[model samples]
Target: MPASKGSRNAVSSAVQQIVLSPSDADYLDQLIPAIKDAAHSNRTAQLLQGLSQFADNHESEIEGVCNTNHQEFVNSVNQLLQVREGTVRLTSEILDLNQSIQASTEKLAEHKKALVDSRSVRQNIDEAAQALEDCLEVLRLTNHVHDLLATKNHYAALRALDELQNVHLREVPQYKIAEMIQKSVPAIQKLIAEAVMTDLKTWLFRIRETSQFLGEVAFYHTELRRTRQKERAEKDPFFRNFKLNSAMDLVSDETDEFDVLDNDEVQVDFSPLFECLHIHEALGESEKFRAEYAATRRQQKDLLLPTSIRLVGDDEGGSLSALLESIAGFAIVERATMKKAFNLRSTVDVDELWDSMCQSAINLITQSLPDIDDADALLKIKGVIALFIQTMENWGYSVAALDSFLLTLFDKYAELLKQKFSRDFLEIVSADDYMPMPIQTSEEYEKVVNVSWYTPEKEQSDISFPCVLPFSQMYPLCCIDIRNFLNQFYFFSDDHFQHPSVIDETLKKSLDELLAQKVCRLLVDRLSSQYLGQIVQILINLEHFETACVELEQLLLAARSPASAGKSVALNATEEFRSNKKTAEKRIFELVNSKIDDLIETAEYDWMAPAAQTEPSNYIQTLTRYLSNIMSSVLLGLPTEIKELIYFDALSHAATMILALPLSADVPTINRNGVAALALDVQHLSQFVDSLGVPILRENLDELQQTVNLLQSDNSDEYYDVSTRNKKYGRVDPMNGPLLLEKLTQGMQSSGRTDKYTTLSSRFGKK
Candidate 1:
């Protein structure tokens, strides 16, 4: 097996050597595989025999193949021989080229050494040339910048300075002239800034000169714009839709019209302003410029106001109008200047300038306010301020500051009116006589009613006047004064506020507080302290005052703004007036009771000695006469309820005093005569009270009458039985029967009739 493997390896080596092409090698490799397969089958001899026969058959083809490969190998050998010859030739050329390159590098080194020796000198010469050119350019530009600054051409001067610094100076930093020019660059910039600012200042001065005309033009333009806008809105479908959908009605009913100013009418030169703005912007100092501009305008506006305020009228209305107009005019000019110069419609700095300008006028107005005392004059000033505010609003300026000022002015006006009304009220009340205001003629009566806020149920027919007037017309003179004051107040408020149905809530609240705290309180205090004797007249006056307060309250309610229409506002003044009326009424009863007390104290009864006819005592007669005098005098004019109350209380109090007299410690004992006198006085009181037509007063005296009857009776039991049968004497106690009988017996014994009283007591058995 080993010999056969060695034989196969030998055959493979021989075949690989003979087979030059890849395809012949592949065919020999296939023949090896077949010989291996034949050897495995023990047919290697047969396979070798077949291979020999195949070689014999293809000998010529094989020889031809050998010849072809040998010829191609010979050709490849010749090609390699040719390549070797070319390489040898190329190597010889490279050697020659290397020699030539070494010679060229030696020459280049000599040239580089020569160039290196002279390069700094050439660079120095070029630098010197550049420096010369740059110095000339710097000097030229510096002179040109100076000339531009001289001519107020700041923008061109700034550009030249920029060229000197960025282009020329950078190239020649070592040059002294360049250094000098660079050092002076800041100074040049400052010069340009100063020149621009100077131009601005001059422009501002020119603006000041033409400020009034400019203001008129601006106002005319604003009005024209507004007119155009309104016309456009009226024609616009979207605006029409908005108008139809909006809840608020149009503010004005008149046609939207304005007088258009001709463009040729006003010619303002804004070149200097524009130049200044451009220079400042180029300098990157726009904020600084704006601040300076605003400050300068503020100073100019402040100078427009007078140092000392002077009133042109009672409220300084005219002077205020003039000051506001000047402020508004200047403000308009400044606004126009801002738009033209800075192209700014509005800025924070500009708004601050306007605020400061308005503040000057506001300060003047505030200073002038304290001296003005009239509400009407304040109203006029308010109208002027309102117009100013409207004008400013139409000019597209904020009226917030002005609106606040108006509110403050309104407060001051309301306060002034309150003070005025309070002063008037005090004057009227101080001069009041607590007497019925006499209306002698129909004309006088009508005038009083008209002035006194006396609203009658119906108009009176024209007729002859009567001497006696109704309660409404019979109020004191102060009522008419109050009415006059109210009329003036309403007129002033109507004029000032200009609202259809409402005044300011703040004003209304202030008025209410003033009426309650000052007016009603003043009247109440005066009536309580000083008018006790004039109670009846005071009641009539209070009634009228209360009615006037109601009218005033209704007016205030009707004048409420729509926003506050549903809100409830309690008028303390109205209730105060009614309270004051009640106070006056209570004062009447107090006066009546006080007089009764005084009359009762003056009475000195003779309880033991008097045995005369059954007539009323001196105290009772005096009290009755006093009551009758009061009923005929002050009480006659009072209302029926009050009159009856006063008279009835007086009589009741008087009867109580007489009844308590006999039981007093001062009157230790009383006899039949004293008892009879007491009974007569009580009867007189009852009859007097009855005559007053008050049954309640008569009923109140029944207790005293019953005690009097018990005192006058001989048999206590019989009297008790008779009085018990009558409800008029029910106030007399049956338990006091024995005590009364014993007192009677003591009185009789004291009068020398002790035995008769003892017999009566025994008969009655102290029942």
Candidate 2:
């Protein structure tokens, strides 16, 4: 292949020289032009030539392509120019930033130098301030040193000290002065001892004289203390802290003949007078005794007064200005008796006079009672008490003493009622008229029962409108008087003693005079026969045993469900109870929070107004409303059951509703209710119970009279009592058992089933 190639190359070399010539190159170029003519001569050639020609004619295409290329080139150049512009801008920014960095560096160096200079200046100021503080401390210490250098002239030494240097001076209290001196300045104790010795030397003789005087003073103090009279001198601690010598020291004085100190060693027997304080107030001679007591008290007061007191040897007519020299002086005795009566000296603290009076009254009532039911007998007993009380007052008994005596009796009777009420199983006795206050309006009455009444003469009745309140109701008023009387003792100095003997004597004399006089005896006889003794005694007894303790509890609890019980129930507001109840006016409106004031104020005492004139149901309902709502509440708040009875109608109505529910409730006469009618038949029973201090119900059960005729026993009949063992407490009482069961069964049938309490059964236990 190489040889052939070489030969061809040799042969082609000659041809190549011919063809490769520059002229040949030019002829070829011309030949290509002639070929173009030939190509035009043939049809095909002509077609090819036409094409070439067309190509020449279509030069716009190539020119267009060239234009396109040029445009692309310009676009690239423009993009490159944009890139170059951005790079130049970036370079200029970098240069500016470098310049700014250099300036910041210079400023930073300046600021650092300034800060260092400022810190140095601040340090210098601090050093100056520290030096000033040190100077002040030095000055303070220097002043303290000056104060410490005290001289024998204590006052001068204090003045020489600098005020600012010794800013504080801590004083030792007297109690610790010795210890403080020993702790801080031991030499001060020696100086104190020397001063004490010097003081002893200067006042030795004077001290002796002073001691003698103090001994006399102390003797008086001893007398005062014995009678609690020292309270006048030593109202504060000043007396105890006094420099006076004690009486014992006075007694030890060396002087036998010329002793200045009083030897008050004579025993003073004040027990005899004090003993009189305990004497009974109602021995028929109460008036005489009270007078004696008053006089004795006045004398004691005058004798014991600081100005009146005289040493036994120093007086006769010397210093003794006799006020009540005799023990029978009225003023002294009266004051003492009054103190005991008024509770200025309480029964517990003063004497048994009050107790004795109470006992006497109780004994009279108990002894005089013909039967528990005989109220007339009770009235008689009351008359006696009134006689005793009034007689004492008339005989110069202190008003306070009389009041106290009455209050004691009232309280004692009230307690008796409570005891009886427990047996009757009554919450309280419900009556319209209480002992001290009576009712005004019959509409206010819910039931009917004869209230404890204080009837004045017909002439006095029209204008007087007098009412009696229960013992409890009267207590506050009485207490006010009693407290006032008692508080009077605060005005008396302890140096005085009150005597009661004169009052006793005066009271006895007065009684004798009254007894001897016919007019007074007639008055007592008339008043006593009607209202005084037996009736009140009986009422107290019946109330206690019949209705006070348990029944009241039930009534109160039932009252809580006002909506169920009936909205007319008088008690509405308990706020007063929680906040402490004030007067009736304030509590009445607030508690009811209704417009009942007009009705209450305008109410009339005409209980028998025809049913035709008034809506019978409405009247009954209104009456019930008055009773349950306001009156019951009033009674509940009071401590005495007797007051509750003041509203006799309300008491009976409520009792009828509660206790006599089993009876026909077809409203009978407007005048009376179930309990009221029962009370009429059993009025005497109250006296029996009162006399025995038992509940009427319990007593009646114990002595059950199968026949109606056997109910009342003669006065001489033997007394009997029933025990819970025979009729267990809460295990149905005989009188109530059958009725209660029947009522319960009826209640269940009438849709009155209860969840809390079970009804009694015939033969079952608690089931």
Candidate 3:
């Protein structure tokens, strides 16, 4: 069949398109499949066209597969041939080796069996040697335990037994070694316990010996005598008539003396108990020893005093005193021993010991307070507390526990004393006195004053003075009572009046405040029942108020710390009284100044009055006398500034009067000379006003001198000018006018000329 031209052309174009564009070739590839189907059904010549289009679409893919697959197949066939040849040669060698292995199989099996048999024998030998070594170690430990027991070293024997217990002997069940160890442990522990018991007995015997030695010391003889004498004095009615020294007495002021005792030559030996206590601690049986020691002390005390009545019975007094002395000696020695152990045992708890000691002391004091018949029991308790504190210091502890306990005890005891004895003290201080009552005058200007004996009084009877005891005696007694209260537990001596180191600073301040409150109470009770003026008068009878201040200051210095002495509330109150009087003086100056012009205008005669007139009309003299009271007892011992201000105030008043005097018609020279004299008196007073002191006072003095000079000047009109341009224009305004500078500055400011005077001084150049 010949192809049509159109079909041939289509085939050529399709081929070109497929070659130019692969996407178009993909489209032709799809169309070629369908075209082939159509050509196969319709025209076979078109199949060739479809075939050519399909070939064009997949030409590169077909060439790549042919090229890659052909080379890969050829290389794989060559490798397979080589591998097949090697396998044939290896098969021949493997068959030959198999024949050789089959020939030697029986010999190799015998060699393996021989090696296994030798390894088993070596393992057995090692097991036997280890067993033998373990058996020897067990036997050695057993022998060591036996040896230690024979030597009576119980602790070492116990340690050996403990070591043997660690052995894990798991031999045959019939073996007796483990059973024997289990059975021997109880017997060994028993032996060690018996040995410890025997050691404890030996130490106890030594402690008894040490206590006996302490009991034989000579220091107790003086203590016994003192106790007996105190007992007798308390019982005797004649002794009761006189006041006994308090339990806390340092010394008696009435005696103005103190007795001294020589140092004792004998001392107790405490070393044996010290050693015993250490041994007990090491044995872990300190509590047991302490219990036993307390029992022994009780037994000895019971044997010494069989009955309670024997304590005071004269027939058995000597025995009772000896028992007390013995008990005291035992306590001291025991404390010393405990102190030694406390110092040595750094790990021992000190709080426990301190609590025990403090509780015991507190119990003793609390139980003994109700039965305080004499100083004997109190003295014993005091000695115990002091010795305990001393031991704490010796043992190198803080000792704050014992100190705090004593403070608590002292507070209760002081309260007891205050309740029982304060009333009697008050009774003694409330005695009646003959001090006259102050009289008030009808005149408004007169200060209230005491009546003169020369005047015939409408009421002849005198008002009773409020206080009974003089402060001179009262202060000393109060101090004594305070000393007795404070020293009971504090151990203050005559030579050492300072607070003991055992009392903290805060506690000391508390005690001082308490005493101050008591003394102030006494002062209030005695002095407050009267008028203030009368109280001052009463104080005047006893001593000068300044003297009282001095005495109080001294008492405070002796009683407490110097830092607090001056600042005490009581002393500050006294200072407040002085301050109040100073304020009153200032108010009185103001009062006198208010009436100065009126007093000057009404005077009929010369300002100076005759000396014979006890009550004068001269207001200046009255003011002078009133002010003199400020320098006298009212403000005595006050600060110097106060006094300076007082004098300056008087100077200012006199200067004001001199400057404010109007031009009077009658007795012009009299008025001028009188004012001049007043100014001269103020100038004389300026000598006492300390020119180099406070600036305000010095300035006042300078003002007063200028006023005095002007009043006495020949040309007074020159200074009287008020013009701003005048040379003498700056004088203080006369007749209560405003200051000259104030006047001139105000006038200039009103005229809007303030800047005119800004440089006035530089322009004028002092005129």
Output the number of the TM-score-best candidate. 1
Off by over 4 Å in 3: 1-199, 202-358, 363-380, 395-398, 413-421, 432-546, 558-767
Evaluated against the true structure, the overall lDDT of model 1 is: 0.65
For candidate 1, write residues 1-767 as lDDT tens digits. Answer: 33466555655554344333367467556544544455445555544444444444445454565577877545644554464454345335434544454456567778898798779778999987877877887788889999988887788899988987898789788777777888888888888988888887887777666655655554445445445445656777454322211222133322533322125565656677777777778788887877687678777766676776665454545556566666666776666666666553356666776787777778878887887777778778777666566566655678777767766766666677777777866776666666655567887767766666666555567545664454533343556555555455455443123342334466556667766776667666766654444667767766766776777677666656666686665667778778888887777777777788888888777878656545676877898898888788767767787777766666667767766677665665668777777777777877777786767767667767777787776545555466453653567656554455566677777777766677776776752
Q: Which lDDT values do the candidates have, in the order given?
A: 0.65, 0.33, 0.45
Positional deviation of residue 494's Cα in model 2 after best superposition, in angstroms: 5.1
Q: How do the candidates rank by TM-score, highest first?
A: 1, 3, 2
TM-score of each candidate?
Answer: 0.62, 0.17, 0.31
Task: Answer with 1 or 3, whichever has the higher lDDT.
Answer: 1
**Candidate RMSDs in order:** 23.3, 48.1, 40.2
Please write out the lDDT profile of model 3 over residues 238-274, one tens digit for every residue: 5432222333221322333311111253344444455
Q: 2 or 3, which is superior by lDDT?
A: 3
> What lDDT is reached at residue 486 by model 3?
50
Best by lDDT: 1
Worst 10 residues of 1 by lDDT: 241-250
Of candidates 3 and 2, the better by TM-score: 3
Model 2: worst 10 consecutive residues (lDDT sum): 708-717
Worst 10 residues of 3 by lDDT: 444-453
